[model samples]
Target: MTPTIRGFEHHRVPVDGDVSLHVAVGGSGSPIVLLHGFPQTHLMWRHVAADLAAGHTVICPDLRGYGASDKPAEAGPGTYSKRTMAADVVALARALGHERFALAGHDRGALVALRAALDHPAAVGHLACLDVLPTLDMWDVMHGVDAAVGFHLYLMAQPPGLPERMIAASADAFFGHFLDRWAADPAAIPADVRSAYLRACAAAVPSIVADYRASAGIDVEHDRADRTAGNRLRMPVTVVQQDWGAALGFDAASIWRAWAPDLRHTLTGHGHFMAEEAPAMIAEELRALLTR
Candidate 1:
């Protein structure tokens, strides 16, 4: 049986003309949307969403091109760009009767949240990003031998055909590599959740690669433009990370501060999949962000 948040009800909410998102919504009061990261689905937020839902309406969605959501072809650079994904988030909220909401995201979703907060500041009351650097700073910090840790980013950034075919040939291995590597406690995922992640990722190889490809191309351009225009996240923002800057030899908080002036930067020892590894703590941080 597929695992789902206990009290949450699921729906396919239409954001674009034919693009609907697979969302699980529960609780009441002010709304809060949680976006999942790469190689995973909204299921990643099962624990945290349920906790936050106790005090706030929680909306957990399989990001377009991930999990059970619609995966449109990579029409162009705009197709899977974070900018487009961010717009989908805004539309989803408004469609569900939330003009503005607190937002939180992990990994790739963090990139989308960052874009959403920047592009639709009026629609996001507060923001929280987990375990990712801004696209522009990510490229800037990663160089030389240390950059090898992010081998998948470079692999997926290639032209459409090659990366897709390469990843598709050994889908499980490619997708499971991160699931196995990034967790501090492998049991945090258990057997069922791990299987779900591998299955979902195997089925969405092309769209997933297209998402990363856009980050390397058009996403960078968007972030660059924002930096040039001196645009910063206008709302209260909280960033929870693993201190990647120490490993990559850069100041992570300083980079985030440049993008989010009203920022609360924090460090976590719970590993990459922190939401799964430390749900209570992740929920606590998000709850605090909502109060800010």
Candidate 2:
């Protein structure tokens, strides 16, 4: 069986008429939604959510097309676009009785949270993004050699059928490669938790590919439009990232500052899966973000 946040209660909240999100809610007071990254479930936030729930209501939901959440077939670019996923998040919070809440996300989830802050500024009181750049800036900064690090992004960006087939053929090996490679300490993710992440990812291959494909297409367009309109995040924002700038040859802080004027960018020594590797530090960063 998969492990969950110790004190949280799970619910299937309807974010759309045909789509419902598998969400975990715990604690009391003001609400804060925690979104999980790629190849993982809401379980990634297990440690951080539990810590935050002591004082604030923590909502951890597996995003659309990941984990136990509803994975609708991709009918168009909008099907898995960050804009749509952001809407689902807003609906989830509203259904749970929060008209507005603080928000935080890691990796792919960070992209979604960024969109939510942009499109629904009034609904997100504060924002925290971990280990990712805005979609437009991401594509801009990735150059020849450094772009190889994001090979999967290019692979999944292909027209639907091929990327889905290649990944699904060796699902465990494909998904497990990330779980193994991205963590600074392999043991940071316990065996059970790791297995749960792989299982959730393998079972949702097509939808996951669709999610990434949308990033390459519709997501970029949205970000471009936002930039053209000078639409910046109005709320205070926090960004926690590894010092990837040193190796990737780009200034991470300057990139994020373009969209977020009230930003606090912290560089961490942890790997991509920092939440699992350094939960205490991540939780503290989030607590500090909430106060801003």
Candidate 3:
């Protein structure tokens, strides 16, 4: 009972050194790549990818350290930097014959998409980010109440071996915590999919932590350099997010506006896994962004 995207053809693509991604391709028009968030695979795009596939060539990939993709041995800075991961996404699209493609990401995947747009503006026709802020803004917005909500980010950002050991001890509980707590309706994630996510995470404790650790260190430095140079997303950008500003007492839109000069920001009461919790809306917003 392996998870499969109906009607989509799957392929393994080599992007970086010994790191290959599992990508699902469907449809036959312009290309649109979808990146999934943490503790989930490209399966997160099951609904949206199918919808977008009706009129576009939708590409969904299990990002480097997650899903059926290669985890790779932890190698410090460059191992799972979003910049490197973002380049993987761009290279993946190009290898598939798309010179430029519409891009969308959820959670961690959103961070990668943001980086891709900044690092290779000419390659991204349009961008959509579901339920996440830029990495730098994400760290800066954390304070009292919100910090409590982001405890895992701090925990996973710890030195290697330590975080991996702790997470491995209670893998299911640790991975399942966010899947249950962050969703408006936990049932939105089918039981089998939930089990699949937990299993993938439990098996790759070190690489998963390395992915987060890069964000705490190198990812931030990369972001700082971009900000210093006044780099902004020149492509049309659309963001869909749960109202973290309302709950956490920070201005979410203003923070995102600083990075996306051409922006469409939508505040939703939908859950953090918005693609699953609200597919039609997510699909509509993404289509709207490309039409611009």
User: What C-alpha root-mean-square deviation, in Å, does candidate 3 show against the real structure?
Assistant: 0.9
Tens-digit lDDT string for candidate 2 (132-198)? 9999998888888977888899999999899999999999999998888788999889999989999
Arrange candidates by lDDT, descending.
Answer: 2, 1, 3
Tell me how far the alpha carbon of residue 75 in candidate 1 is from the true structure, in angstroms, after superposition: 0.8
Show model 3 residue runs off by greater than 4 Å. Answer: none
Q: What is the C-alpha lDDT of each candidate?
A: 0.94, 0.94, 0.91
Give lDDT tens digits, candidate 3, residues 1-292: 8777789999999988788999999998989999999889899999989998899999999998888899998777888999999999998998899989999999999999999999999999899998898999889888886579899899989988788999999999999999989999787799988888998889878888999999999999999999999999998989999888886888878988899878899899889988988889899998898899
lDDT of 3 at 87: 96
Candidate 1 residues 59-174, lDDT tens each? 99999999999999999999999999999999999999999999999999999999999999999999999999999999999998988989999999998899999999999999
Indicate the residue-level lDDT of 3 in model 1. 81
Question: CA shift at 272, candidate 3, in angstroms?
Answer: 0.7
* Cα displacement (Å) at residue 124, model 3: 0.8
